[model samples]
Target chain A: MLKRTPLHDWHVAHGARMVEFAGWEMPVQYTSVVEEHNAVRTAVGLFDVSHMGEIRVRGRGALPLLQHLVTNDVSRLSPARALYTPMCREDGGTLDDLLIYHLGEDDYLAVVNAANTERDLAWFRAHAEGAGDVDVLDETDRWALFAVQGPRAEEVLQPLVEADLKRLRYYHCIPGTSLAGVSGAIVARTGYTGEDGFECYLPAGAVHEAWEAVWGRVQALNGRLCGLGARDTLRLEAALPLYGHELTETINPLEARLGAFVKLEKGPFIGREALAAAKAEGPRRRLCGLRLLERGIPRAGYAVHRASAGGPDGSWEAEPCGYVTSGTFAPYLHQPIALALVGGGAAPGERMAVDIRGRLVPAEVVPLPFYKRGAAAPGS
Target chain B: MEFPQDLKYTEEHEWVRASRDLAVVGITDYAQSELGDVVYVELPAVGARVKKGASFGVVESVKSVSDLFAPVSGEVVRVNGALADHPEKVNEDPYGEGWMIEIRMDDPSELEDLLSAAEYAARVE
Candidate 1:
């Protein structure tokens, strides 16, 4: 049986195409994926992200436990700031990448991927045993998370929020605020879409009313009721890593191009020794962006190759070098783009090919992000 | 999802419009709407041989890809080249400009095996 969010019925009523994702019945899109994706790029977009898991850790040991479990320096986090980091196993393999929000002194909330909820909770419990004075509790069902993202996100949400939206800096939060008449909501200036946005965590029981109120303004601005499809495209365009695709149990932070979030110098963590050694040796396969030079959309698991000269009949052939991790035809760029784990020192501007259904399509190694906000729009 | 009375439909959600031995092929409205926004299409080369119930091409939407099947066995006389640059035509006008191929059917009588508009509509419903 698939789990359903509180907005499942609402999504169905609004003509959303529901699909099973991560063992949950989630909305994939409404009218069209491209339209929803473009809406977030040009205007405001609302997302029902209640399926994400939130685990709470409180007490004096919270800071120490967090610093030991995650790759980032959690001691730097304050009540007003949030941190992003990747938790790993003993051998430097990624467990999951999550955002840690400091709800209070010695109290923190770690938002994790829905699919990894059970495993992550268990990992936390096992580590917290005999660590110190700490209490780890699963708070996944306590909140309904909504992401209001885009250039006009603030304007769309400011009217219903009590706190000053502009005052909340990026990666900062106001733990207790009123949103759409709901008190004790957490409004944080953070998002995965690479947009100026806010993520509001409303009490689960009162979420419907709050969502309805905020959605009214969102609809007034012609913003989109985005789903997981648009969310995936938006994050991909911004070069944000998806756990299963870009970061996995076998894919280390360094190989996934997330070294900035991994603090090797930080005193001993679970995977500290392995991570430090891997860092010194340098990653064997580096994740990089690939843009198709010819027609053909690359998909995950497709073999990436070092392009060779065409055959006599102009047939394409190449030697395998890597494989694509995540790819799609970018709506904003109007071109096919992908992230590939390339080996043997593949550099930007090097010619490559993606083997698509027995055909080798030409491509080029490019920079990470396929799109960035504030940059000139395509065809401008 | 409109199933034109003049066209024959297949269980695979493809439609065929035949005039004598030559047939025009395109996916049904139900198929295109289910697939969502079309981004790319792969079509068979002109003069390629296609067999009934065989996969001939590919139509890729933003989120997924679907195979285009042959409704009837024939030789591909032409393909809609415009879809190479404007794949959205498949969603905008699947019956008109979005038609995928023109096939010279080897057995014109095979059209009798296809479902009528009413039958196709009922099957989808």
Candidate 2:
């Protein structure tokens, strides 16, 4: 049976096309993805991200337990600050990528992917066995998340919430009473779209009211209700890695070019030993951005190839180098772009070919983030 | 919403407009709206023989890919190659400019089994 969020009726009422995503019935789009994507890029957009898992870890050992499970050093996070980190297995493969919010001295919340909730909680429980007073609770069903993202996101959200959103820096969050009447929603001044935005975590029952309030405010500012399709495109434009596509069980954090999150010097995490070794000896395959040289858009699972040596039969026949992990027609860049996992030789400016529908489309290895809007950067 | 009573439809959301032994095949307006923006369309080659209820081609949007099923067993007389360059026409006008293929119907009587516009709309709901 498919689960439904509190705003499922709201989505249906708003003409949202609903689909089963991660066991929950969610809206894939309200309008066109291109229009919604452009809305978030240029104006403002809201997303129903209630499907994402919110796991709370609290007690005296919550800090140490989180530090041990994730690649990032959680010790550095001051109260109400958040850190984007990758949770790895004992073999250094990524279990999932999550955002760790240090809510208080003994409280921390890990927002993980919906599909990986059970696996992540299992990992935490197993690893955090000996840790002091640690409690890992899956609070996914208890809350509803809404993301207001874009340049004018703050302007739309500020009127409804009492929190001083301007004072809340990027990656910082605060607990506040909802103006929509949900008392204890956590408003985080962080977003995946690489735009100025806020992610609100409110009580599940009160989500409809909160959504109505936010939507009204957004409509007043000419904001849009975006869907998962636009959410994926916007994040891809920002070069933010999707958990399953960019960072998977088969992919290491270092190879995904997220080494900044991996603190090898930090003591005794689940994948600490293997990660340390990977850091010492560089990764075999590295993820890089690709800009298509031809008309075709490069898509995920398309083989990356280089021209083979020798005669026309071999020379003209491209040799498979790697594969594209994610690709999209970047609305912001107005060009086809992709994230490819290629060999070490595939450096920036290097030429390659992406196999699209049995044809090799020429592409160039480009720098990460095919489009960057304003001053937003990774970890900013 | 704008179901032309003259047209016949399949459970798979394909619309068929028959003219003697020649039939025009396209997706319904409901299918187009559900699929969102159609980015690329793969059509069966001209002269290719297709079977009723078989996969004939694919229609890809920005979000998902859907198979185009043949409503009647026939030989492909012509394909709308214009869709290769401009697939969004399907979303704009699925029954008109978005007609996927023209088929030389193998059995014109098969159209009798298909649902009329009202029946198809009822089935979808």
How accurate locally is residue A216 in candidate 1, as Cα lDDT from 0 to 100?
94
DockQ leader: 1
Clash number for each model: 0, 0
Q: lDDT score, residue B19, model 1?
A: 99
lDDT of 1: 0.91
TM-score of the A chain in candidate 1? 0.97
Off-target runs (Cα >4 Å) in candidate 2 are A177-181, A293-299, A308-315, A331-335, A374-380, B20-22, B44-56, B70-81, B104-115
Q: Which pairs clash (backbone N, Cα, C closer than 3 Å) in model 1?
A: none
* Candidate 2 residue lDDT tens string, A1-380: 99888889889999898888888999889999888988887789999999999999999989888888888999889998999999999999999999988888799889999889988889888877887698989899998999999999889878777778889899999865665666888999889997889899998988887888889988888889998888998999888999889989989999999999998887888898988898888888899999888666678898999754458564555788899999976766766789988877467887788998777888888887777777333333
Q: What local lDDT score does residue A331 receive in model 1, on the 0 to 100 scale?
A: 83
